[model samples]
Target: MRRVVQYSTGNVGQHSLRAIIGRPDLELVGVHAADPAKVGRDAAELCGLTEPTGIVATDDVDALIALAPDCVVYTALGETRPMEALSEMSALLAAGINVVGTSMVWLVTPRQADDWLRVPLEQACAAGNSSLYVNGIDPGFSGDTAVHAALSLVTRAASITVQEIFDYGNYDDYEYTGTAMGFGNTADAERPLTFRPGVIATIFGGLVRNLAAHLDVELDDIRERYEPWYSDQHIECRMTTIEPGQLAAVKFSVEGVRGGDTVITVEHVNRLTSKAAPDWEFPPDGQSGVHKVVVEGEPRIEMSTSLSHPALDVTEAGCLSTAARAVNAIDWVCRSPAGLVALEDIPPTELIRGVMW
Candidate 1:
């Protein structure tokens, strides 16, 4: 069995945790958490997973590496200290362990920054005879792969837009609503761009950039805008009423240039009322939306994704769908030309569905 180590303590980590469960081909090896209190606790329990299963969370990353797992799945929040976290991931890959992660604004490979984060890691992985891939539920599935799939048939494509609206009205889970998107008072507002410096090249930014690169068009320009949700009157949500305050409804957008020099656009938004912005043209998932992707072309392609989970921003179905693509593509990256790669680098037919049902 292939041993996989995971290093995330929240929703992203949850994706990895659920991915490894009950899989005979892969073994759940070790888990790493930042909280000292969580250290030494069984990972399954930390995740509210019943049955001690013998896998424990450890604070000692070095020790975890010493265990020499074949691969590490990193899902830690990459915003606070992305470079540092990436450095740690690089070390593990250098130590000869294949690495997979989703700690970015978008995809992490095919970077353009002068330092270009993934290069050194790829070089290290190659040196150590390992491989690395950065995967995210949205950026990987709904945005990039989905867009790539759509663009495939366009002989004279004009533009593409993607949306993933989530209805969180029924979301009874606090962690799912609050922290999945950092929804405190100033969370949705204009705050200092502290982490994820390459916000454009991160998340959908990189995918947008990659698309432009694939089209062989010079990047026209990139811009980011935000919308704050404010309720004039107290709005009732389940048991609680939300007062007037600005939490973000939209985070960022990238406007690209096509070969015709026409502008192509890709955007990411957090939450918004479907009724609030009828003028925006962007589709709203429903009440308390979680994930939404809208793609527009010469004609148009609109896909609305909704998942049902009692207590998470992304449903189990969403995570499973995304992870299955990443997990099954492991062999593709292993065999492909070594370097930073985007979804466009691989064939869409390679998508690994958990089952044919």
Candidate 2:
């Protein structure tokens, strides 16, 4: 059994902790809590489990490293603190702990990451002979594996588009939905950090570039487009309140263009409420969220994936999938060669085992 450490207790991290505890092939050795109050608590209590796991959460990185875990499931928020996230992951890797995480979306395709970002992690892995893999629902399975699976059914493909359509009404992360995304900000206010030029590309562009590279297609340039929808009335979401005429939804895409034609695209249709964007795409059958892949070619293929959990809301279930993507890959990541491992590097069927269902 591989010893594991869970590196946060946020939305995704909690799920990661729970999955690690549920799995019979993994041992929960330690947990790193970002919040001071969470420190010293039992891992099970932090993740909503009724029973204790005997393992306690800590804020000390060195203490976690001292455990000598085979891998660490990192789900820390990295969108705003990219550098700090990088440094923390690097420290883990350099200390000989393999890592699988949903943070650092750019690392989903490490080949496309800038040298400054990629080199340090590579060096750390070399120093410790460890490996790091990063993925999640959107930049993780939807854009990579799921889209590739759809492509296999097509004889020829002209353009590929991956979409994440979700209603964030139940999403409870205020810092993300409010400050980072500007979901409740007035339409006239400055664009949120996420809507700024190149931010979308930095986050989701790696998927486009990775797809293009897989097809052996050279991209002329990567382009971005942002469109916002304003609320017609006051709308209160679990995360933030949207006033009349305030931004409530956003539709954005990062496209990979080749010779003036877009080849690969990653798009998101995120709304604070269903009423925010009537014209924009919505999940089929009134579902709150769905990840879709559309390929236009000889035989057009469209595949949509929706997730649900009996005890959790749609948004929470989505977070569980994100956590599972990395947690399930623990064994493969541990056995793989040292360095940044990409989705393509992993055997498609190697990680499937011990499913509860």
Task: List, in order, the clash count of every candidate structure.
Answer: 22, 0
Candidate 2 per-residue lDDT over residues 1-357, each given as its tens digit: 999999999999999999999898999999999899999999999999989999999999999999999999999998789899999999999999999999988898999998979999999999999999998897789999999999999999999999999998888997865677788777678998888988888888888988998999999999999998888898877978888888889899999999999988899999987888999889999999999999999799999999998889999999999998899899999999999999999988875755553
TM-score of each: 0.79, 0.98
For model 2, where is the 10-residue window of minimal lDDT? 348-357
Error of 1 at 6 (Å): 1.5
Where is model 1 more than 4 Å wrong at Cα? 113-116, 167-190, 194-204, 235-242, 258-262, 272-299, 309-325, 331-341, 346-350, 353-357
Write out the backbone clash pairs for model 2: none
Model 2 ranges with Cα > 4 A deviation: none
Residue by residue across 83-169, what tens digits does model 1's lDDT show? 887688778878887776666544443564235565677677777787767766566666666666576655656666655554333
**lDDT (C-alpha, whole model) for all candidates:** 0.59, 0.91
